[model samples]
Target: MKEKIKIGMIGLGGRGMGLLRLVILNMSDVEVVALCDRYEDRQTKAADKVEEKQGSRPFVTIDYQEVLSIDEIDAVIISTSWADHIDIAIASMEAGKYVATEVGGAYSVQECWRLVEAYERTKIPCMILENCCYGRDELMVLNMVKQGLFGEIVHCAGGYQHDLRDEIAYGYENRHYRLDNYINRNCENYPTHEIGPIARILDINRGNRMVSLVSMASKAKGMKEYIKNEKSHDSELAKLDFMQGDIVTTIIKCAHGETITITLDTTLPRYYSRGFTVRGTKGMYTEENQSVYIDGSHDHYQSWNKNWGNAEEFREKYEHPIWSKFLEEGVQGGHGGADWLVLADFFESVKKGTQTPLDVYDMASWMCISTLSEDSIAMGGHPIAIPDFTNGKWITRQ
Candidate 1:
């Protein structure tokens, strides 16, 4: 077994830096040997932080290829822009480095295929860092589903329903990538956060898979209204026409007769929520209310108002083994300790030289939702066929 996992940290943006500070730096068994970003200042800042923590500065470079060229690096953590993720991941895999890419949707189906192709060619494991999949509530629900609490799940719904008006409006000032996407494209631009956990619950790419989907986007008005109302934002942003809609709803049909609905609702005003929900023949779990309702266990009609937040009551019995262990070990890291859990899972797989829990196929299928939704929305909400990136292997992936 490897004594230490040498890592190359790519994309020194807010997300990248946060993961570095909150998760990677804290892992005693991991060493960041290299850092890369387009911007020099970001690279310098990250180097300084790593030096402060580890008493040694990482090799900093503007070109990500330089980081890939390092012989000692065993894996890479890609937290770059949405457009750059697949290319960087493909390159990393080709370099024989295990890959853990931060979550984002794909720009095109072809690029998604290239990710799968690269993994197949290199035989290097690539994992999507979908922190939400390891979320405590999500895992508890997943365990409940697996244990037959929510028997025969028929439908699942989730959404990225956080208001990002300020972030989108000031992206240029912050040097963030989301502003350009909002101006040029309209689709379910960010779907993985909500879809990841839901897909796992539905066993997508294992026993079931998303076969087709149709998406509809509401009119783009949130950014314009926010820019117009907020005088602090760049005045030029008010005049620019934004293509991204305030709300994008996508319905995905699975091969197993289950349907999944995911909504992209970042621009609108709302409290943060994935709005994760599961419905089955026996019971249901709803994140909005933090409640789980099981048939024959609770009053079906009149007692729901009293059952709000009752999922906590079942935690001792239904908590996922992972979370049960996590609690015992003490939760740490961002997103309610999900960040730590996901990174740990990836590193464990790397150490063991085993397949990732969420492999390239999962990344391809989930990320393609954005591109496929774009096509569906462009064609007046016509359903588009989802590509089987697994090449018929999903039938017996278990």
Candidate 2:
């Protein structure tokens, strides 16, 4: 392991800069060696931030390939647009650098497979930086599930239910990538936020795999309505029609006979919530209510509302060990400290040459949800088989 793990940060967009400012630069044992973005302004801004923090300007480039070419960079943190994640991750792996890609759905199952193949060919670790996987509530629920509290987990449900209307409508003005996606594609565009933790609970791509999924999309009215009501009559966005549905619901059946339901509810009016929920024979956890209900412990039919916010009571006993240490060390960074934890995990794995918690197979399977949902919705909610990226290795993988 190097004395200090060196990093190349690609895609200096809002997300990229936020991760750099909040997490990577705050770490004592990591160094930012290079930064890349298509826009020179973004690259320059990121370089300036690095210089202010580390007292040295990082090598900046408009082309991501330049970041990958740096032989001394131990790993690359890819926070690029959704469409660019797979390509850059593959390139980073091929260049013999560890990869940590931001959360986004995949464009195609073929590309997802290609990502897996790249990791296999190079033997370089590739991790999806799905911070939600390290979420406090998520880890607590995962620990409960592992300890047999959620016995024989039968069903899990979650959603990316955020109102992204303004973000999508102003994408051109803000230089964001979502507007183009809304204009051209309609599927569950973002799935990993909720699904990442659920997959860990169910052991997807480990002990089980998602076999098939059926998706149905509602009418695409959110963005258009937002533009008409909020934007100027002559705004260019008013001339555009969004193809992405206001709400996309997907039902996935796992090979272990467990079922998972994920919804993409962006492009609508709603407060943020992942709507993480887990159900098992013995108990259940619902994020909306911030509650846990054990069959025998709580009154099932009556006093359901009384049990709301009860998950907090179990925190001391059931909190995951990772979060326990995080609390002791003081939680830091964005998204309720999940961003710091996930980045720390990735860097630690890079330094130790160890397998990341979220490996290439996990990334491929979780990301393929978007492309598969697109196919399913195109076929009028027909079920599509999710490719087993683990190539049947999931049957015995632990």
Candidate 3:
């Protein structure tokens, strides 16, 4: 822990580059030791970014294996495609390095169990870096729930409603052709962002585990066609799948009897939306206007008390010294500066030999869809089992 955590970057794509920039700019506790990407331009550009910020460059390579086998790296960040998550995480964990993966845990049940086993056997820290939990509105929602403002949160709804049709089509035109379709196909396919904060609020896997989930999906929408077939038709992805417009709605029952309704929809073309309409026995919370209705007294309280609970304004009034220290001097990059905090926490936790912000079990619970979604889809929307991370050892492991 005395030495800076030697880190490696596996993908230098948009999200990958975002994380890299954050890590290089904000973290003194970690040093990026390697950079990798399929494209030669991305690799060179990212390495230059690191060198620009830190006055030193990391070992740059096109081969992922070179990154995995590098002796100087202590941890790796997998920010690549959804399909490669399981393999990359498994390989990194087996190599005895802590892995902080972007999202979507394993794609199948066996892979989920394999990840759990790998971490358990190695005793190494592996986590999903879901940045939504770090958002200000989400944090306020968690604080309110913890304070019992939403007494017995009965039902909550969360999902990603961003319109990626434009970005998907024109984004890596000259480089990869099939990228957008691969990303756009699944529903709530990347649920960690939408589900993470809500799970923390509900104490998922901490107090209640996601017991079962049922899902249903809508037909394909042509984001690729919007780009490939329309304006950007002359672009490289002229024949991409672009994805069918889909809305995969999932209902998750937590062990403690609370139910969370999760939905995944992209390609339908919408204004960007990711907020919950939370209902509880005593009160309810709405993201529509950032208001909280109470059980007993007071007019409807708007979390917007500071900056309208707008993440921007929250920072102005957010006075916690520890968090303030992070917000002040640190450089801002991704997701309104939350990404920087994620890296800082990981490095800090490694220094203390404690768990990162979201532990492996917490990650598994939020990301269970990597296995559960397809099963529910295949079974015609039947309930599917979620694995217990405690491994039936809550009574024993404790």
lDDT of each: 0.93, 0.92, 0.70
lDDT of 1 by residue, 1-398 (tens): 67689999999999999999999999998999999999989999999999999999899999999999999999999999999999999999999999999998899999999999999999999999999999999999999999999899999999999999988887987899999999999999989998899989999999889999999999998888888888435657778989999999999999999999999998877899999999999999999999988889888768577879989999899889999999999999998999999999999988888899999999999999999999999999999999999999999998
Worst 10 residues of 3 by lDDT: 307-316
Report the lDDT tens digits of candidate 2 across residue range 1-398.
75589999999899999999999999999999999998989988899989999999999888889988988999999998999999999999999999999999999999999999998899999999999999999999999999999789999999999998888877888899999999999999999997899999999988888999999999999888888999856467788888899999999999989999999998888898999999999989999999998888887679678778989999999999999999999999999999999999999898888999899999999999999999999999999999989888998998
lDDT accuracy of residue 340 in candidate 3: 72
Model 1 residue 269 distance off true place after TM-score fit, in angstroms: 1.2
What candidate 3 gets wrong by more than 4 Å, as runs, is 1-3, 171-186, 222-245, 298-331, 394-398
| Model 2 deviation from the true structure expressed as Cα RMSD, one decimal place | 1.0
- Ranked by TM-score, the better of candidates 2 and 3 is 2
Taking all chains together, the TM-score of candidate 1 against the true structure is: 0.99
| Best lDDT among the predictions, by candidate number | 1
Off by over 4 Å in 1: none
Better of 1 and 3 by TM-score: 1
Query: Any residue pairs clashing in model 3, and if so which?
Result: 188-264, 220-244, 220-245, 221-244, 221-245, 224-242, 304-308, 304-309
Candidate 1: the clashing residue pairs are: none
